[model samples]
Target: MSKKGKSRKKPRLPEEQDLDTFEFRPTGLNLKWTKDLITVFDGYRIHRCYDLTFIERAIGEGQMPRSFVDQWRFIRTILHRFAAVSPKIPGVMEKYKRRQVVRFVTLVLLTIAVPLMVATFVFSITAIAP
Candidate 1:
């Protein structure tokens, strides 16, 4: 008896919301969180680094593939959990900013180096022939 054939429905999954594309995109906070989460394991705790042990266990439990253990989704989940538990941390943004600066500098240096090398090669060739 309704005029509209179908009513619009809200998203059922929280993860599916606010996402514009189907492709994966882990937030900067999430990456940092994942980095922090790896410290919980004994091997990782001693090194203060991430290792394959937790991922291997998840794969053994059939939660994820052995190969996909280190995939973006796995890391993102850890990051999301980390974000929930520890939302605020001093100097986190600064670290990300530093990383960005380093990436930019490396790109600029490569750009300049390539052109300078090519120009030097051309100039040397012309000088030797004259």
Candidate 2:
């Protein structure tokens, strides 16, 4: 086939292919959200601490009972699920949608009405004088 006549193939997207074959890894809360949350906590001078070594040690030493590990894994999965659901965009969109519509409508009316209002005031004053 001549190069001019041949069609170029598009690159494959891994996510678009079979999901079962894909190895999905979890990344913790995104940087912006984490930073925002940290800002709120920092504003109040709150301290946060976590010690995950205990879990590692328990697992390495076989001290973690099977049931305990199962429960912890379940809890971790639940937290990850919740984190997946909760984020800033949807909440922000909702907040703006709730209050912003009114603010925007008010702004639009003011923009249209201000000049007319000034004209009316000048006309009324001239009428009063004559």
Candidate 3:
């Protein structure tokens, strides 16, 4: 094929190119969320310390039969569960949740509205044509 007839491929811009290596650099929002989560966990730990102390005393007194390994495992499990369901961080998580909901609703509306608009435009044009 002649060079003139051959289709030239467009060169990709830097922004259009796919990244080869992905490094997780947390954004300001993510850092804020992390700080809030840590704060909540710290507060939760402070409140639960007395319960933990009581449990430890019970085990030491032979009232609750639990091995050291079992006790550690139990504590770890409780902390993990708490972290998973930690109450919504007052501003950070609540805002994130609301944004997600708004985004979803917007996408759903656009998905329905765009096709309807296009169909209406096409029908109107056909009606106007001879």
Candidate 4:
């Protein structure tokens, strides 16, 4: 295959995510949730403060997770088991809760809907040209 047939490099996002702006400190109240999150994400090598912050960023702020959609999905998958318990995880509530709705909707739009739309647009253009 010709080199042109292969995809070019992806562009860097204009503004790099300021992950430094956030911090996640596990506490006495939410200790169980934090431990459970670690257990659920086992083998992903989540070991540092930054790792927790990244997950928090993804779920709470609607920012993209760093190449860990599989783990992210797993984290979300167990939500039914953990989300409604006594003390909620700090990251997945209010800004990222079913109660708020807006954050979740925006996440869906950015991750799923926009990508689909872009693919359709590209397909339509190529189909029309040829």
Model 3: CA > 4 A from native: 1-89
- lDDT for each residue of candidate 1 in 25-130, tens digit (9 for 90 to 100): 3233345445544454333323334444664465568755343433444444444455544225677668868989999999999999999999999999999995
Native-referenced Cα lDDT, model 2? 0.53
Tens digit of per-residue lDDT, candidate 4, span 1-130: 4675777898533342333552333333245556656664453333212234645664575444344442444344344334344245565455435656877778877999888999999999999995
As for TM-score, the candidate ahead, 1 or 3, is 1
Worst 10 residues of 4 by lDDT: 43-52
Model 2, runs deviating above 4 Å: 1-92
Best TM-score among the predictions, by candidate number: 1
Candidate 2 residue lDDT tens string, 1-130: 4576768899543233333563433234356634543553343332122334555575568755555444444433433444444344357558658788999999999999999999999999999995
Q: What TM-score would every model get versus the actual structure?
A: 0.38, 0.30, 0.33, 0.24
lDDT minimum window of 10 residues, candidate 1: 41-50
* Total clashes in model 2, counting residue pairs 3 or more apart in sequence or in different chains: 0
Q: Alpha-carbon error at 42 in model 4, in Å?
A: 41
By summed lDDT, which 10 consecutive residues of candidate 3 come out lowest?
A: 16-25
Model 1's TM-score against the true structure: 0.38
Model 4 regions lying over 4 Å from their true place: 1-100
- Global local distance difference test of model 3: 0.55
TM-score-based ranking, best first?
1, 3, 2, 4
Reference-based lDDT, each prediction: 0.55, 0.53, 0.55, 0.51
Error of 1 at 116 (Å): 1.4
For every candidate structure, what is the RMSD over all alpha carbons to the true structure, in angstroms?
13.2, 16.2, 26.0, 21.7
Report how far off residue 69 is in candidate 3 (Å).
38
